[model samples]
Target: MSLRGKRLFSVNCTLGLACLTLCCSVSPLFGQESSTSSSGRWLAPDALVTIAPAMEPGETFQGPVDLPLVLNNPDIAWDPHYAPKSDTLAEMGRDVVFRGEVYCLEFSFKPVRMIAVDIPSFTGVQRKNVWYLLYRVRYLGGDLRPQVEPDAFGNQVFATPQSVAAETISTPKRFFPVFRLQVKGIDREYPDEILPAAKRAIAARERVGQPLYDTVEIMKQSLPVTTAAGGHSLWGVATWVDVDPRTDFFAVLVQGLTNAQQLKMQGEQIEYLQKTLVLHFSRPGDTMDEMQDRIRYGIPALEDPQRQQYILDQFGVEKRLDHLWTYR
Candidate 1:
């Protein structure tokens, strides 16, 4: 064989090895990008797909439409006829109730992310750190509604004795979510704030091309019913600023995803509770150095088991819970 032929063969072998090494390194990154990309990414709704029932039938106090009173003169005597009913009567006359069955939208979200942006404040425009959550809501038909049936007397009565029955309600539903970011232990709450700059930055960073609505704009969006072809899901972003950097444990409380509510009796007062979605998160490492990527979605039991109980206590759950729907 010629001397130049052997040299040429050696050069070709070296080039092939280099090409293979380059592909090996780039392949992992390419795969990661594909997985994280919007088209390929999806978090299942899981438990959030079910319906949330109302605590009790909503009640309206039956009283005189007009009250007998004299603003300027204090000589007006209280009339028994115009007096309001007693608490016992109010409970007994709860015949008029609303929202027998509350339909909750199916919700799924990505890990909460953080970004810094210049926001306008009372003093002046300042650079602020913002945390935002990207989420999608889908409407799946078949929610329980109050059902009625004919009794032995041939009279239409509620199938269940309690007036609550298994039923399905078909109608258009809207989402008006209220996001509250609460720091565990300290119990400091930070309500969601709309930061246009932070939202734009997040959209570009996350490569989200869909129209991401804020809390207000999301109210107008009507979630379409899911079908075999595809399930129509609406994407939105909830943002919060001025989060305490020293915070290690926090949870995002999402309300308005469902109209399910319960009437609570506390002494002489009545309290109304709404079904809310709580997303638990933990941030580990030194508090001085705050990094968005360090914030994790679920409990970090493996990393720090000591802090797990403290975080779970805040949500009133004994065990590890990443997300849950409860009356708040």
Candidate 2:
């Protein structure tokens, strides 16, 4: 008999025995069935084992009848999705598990890449790429509710279940065949050849310009008045200020260029001054306070009298000097 037939018989036998036990109060014969339930005690003719025809000492028996002792079918079939058709003849080397009710499966594969050489340039380029595919298949008719619950770490986790409500389902019902194919090398063309050409096209039409548009002569004429006493021109005072610099005032002057021309030129000068100050203070590993003190005494070349006066007014000379020592 077939494996399915045997299963059906076993199921029927179990049901019959259950019914007999239930009807035992009405029939006395039902009690006898319970007493003979142990193995080696025959409840039915097929359920009991019969010893084979005695083999002569050391004489072997091998035939169709002998095969029945070894032959046993587990009654399992390969999943249809990954299995090859009768015409295709491709064998699935990997093991796969399938649950007909839930219709979900997962597996792994290694990615492969193919490279090709361009005939004109003789340069190798990536041609094709393949990624490992793994999936879970689901039947459309079953419930597809999301199984989400908070985990111990206070994060939500999803569990795979056989069925869920229609409203809670998100994934589309589709057949997923999980597979790992050792795909042989195949050359497929890349799609980014036009990217470099596009970039070149944009670069050829770009424009560039400077910040302040005024002429250099206009900048010289707008120089601020010198605050030095006794016939000292602003240029002379600037020279003297640099010689014995007051660092704090220089920072204030640089900060006051909110509406000044020659902005780029002033920026370059400030950068140079900062670089020089850093080198001087860093030579012997001077402490932050000492470097700040040196900066506090350096004066700036200001080109606006009103801006200069504003700085002195907002922060008194002493306070401004203190700031130079502490300013970042």
Candidate 3:
């Protein structure tokens, strides 16, 4: 890869970590359908993210509030606003972790005083196929009721299920097979990437005299103020199943302008492209054994030579992954 490609990859890697990195706890992000209860989950659990309101803003921030992330899904507009709390994570989001997919996240947001909506129901739910889960979480929200309830933590456990499922890809006929190569179960440490990634993503674009608009910047600001006391992250690699199995999957940069800012490029220029958001959280350069698990960077190591070599050079690759993390 070229120099710019390397820099971009680093930024992508760091930001991916920032997006889903949360405090330590049980795999609240893990749950599956069994021979049990009520309805279907409108939103796939695999793609859910939880954020707590920042009661007190941090040093670099001013009144950061919690709001559902809005992606450009012509199918779904806004997600049901989800207010998260440290205790309620158990109920907020959990995935029926197949194979070894894992996620963690935290936000330095003060609780916003907004009207409360009752959490949606998945009382008795069934798991959707892989493709369905990918599409809904990747590009849609805001139709069905949310999956939520108060867990023992006194925190409201919830899932943002839309009131009505958008017809966009409602049926399988409308769905086309998306190529995916997911290689899970690997871990490593690259404390060096944090600061540089934040600065690089910020310098790329400054908004209103502030660069917080960038994802990495958002992470930089959020990490300190937010804490998942018992959180951990995972790392692994794979090219999309159909894509170059040799070349591993990489990061998601908004390409042109961030996808949300695409409104200005409407008409012929409006290309509603989709970028996957992977979240992982970990502290940089910390050596506390109390911290057993750590944030797993979502960047999957591809079997391709370029990708494996790039990761090896950029972040120290773990020995366990050395088997696939080899040259082409």
Whose lDDT is greatest here?
Answer: 1
- Tens digits of per-residue lDDT for model 1, 189-254: 999988887777887777543678888888998766654444466778999987888777889999
lDDT of each: 0.66, 0.24, 0.25
Q: How accurate is candidate 3 locally (lDDT)?
A: 0.25
Winner of 1 and 2 under TM-score:
1
Task: Please report, as a residue range, the 10-residue window in candidate 3 with the lowest summed lDDT.
Answer: 128-137
Candidate 2 RMSD to the real structure? 46.0
Ranked candidates (TM-score, high to low) = 1, 3, 2
Best by TM-score: 1
Order of quality (lDDT):
1, 3, 2
Return model 1's CA RMSD, one decimal. 9.4
lDDT of 1 at 74: 38
Residue-pair clashes per candidate, as listed?
A: 1, 13, 49
| Candidate 3 lDDT, 1-328, residue by residue in tens | 9999999999999987776564222133322211111222233442333332111111111112221221222333324446544324332222211111111122111111111112223674322111001111111211223355788888885543324332332321111112222222222111111223323322232111222222222222321111123221111111111111121222211111111111122332323233222222111223233123232334344688775566554334442131121110
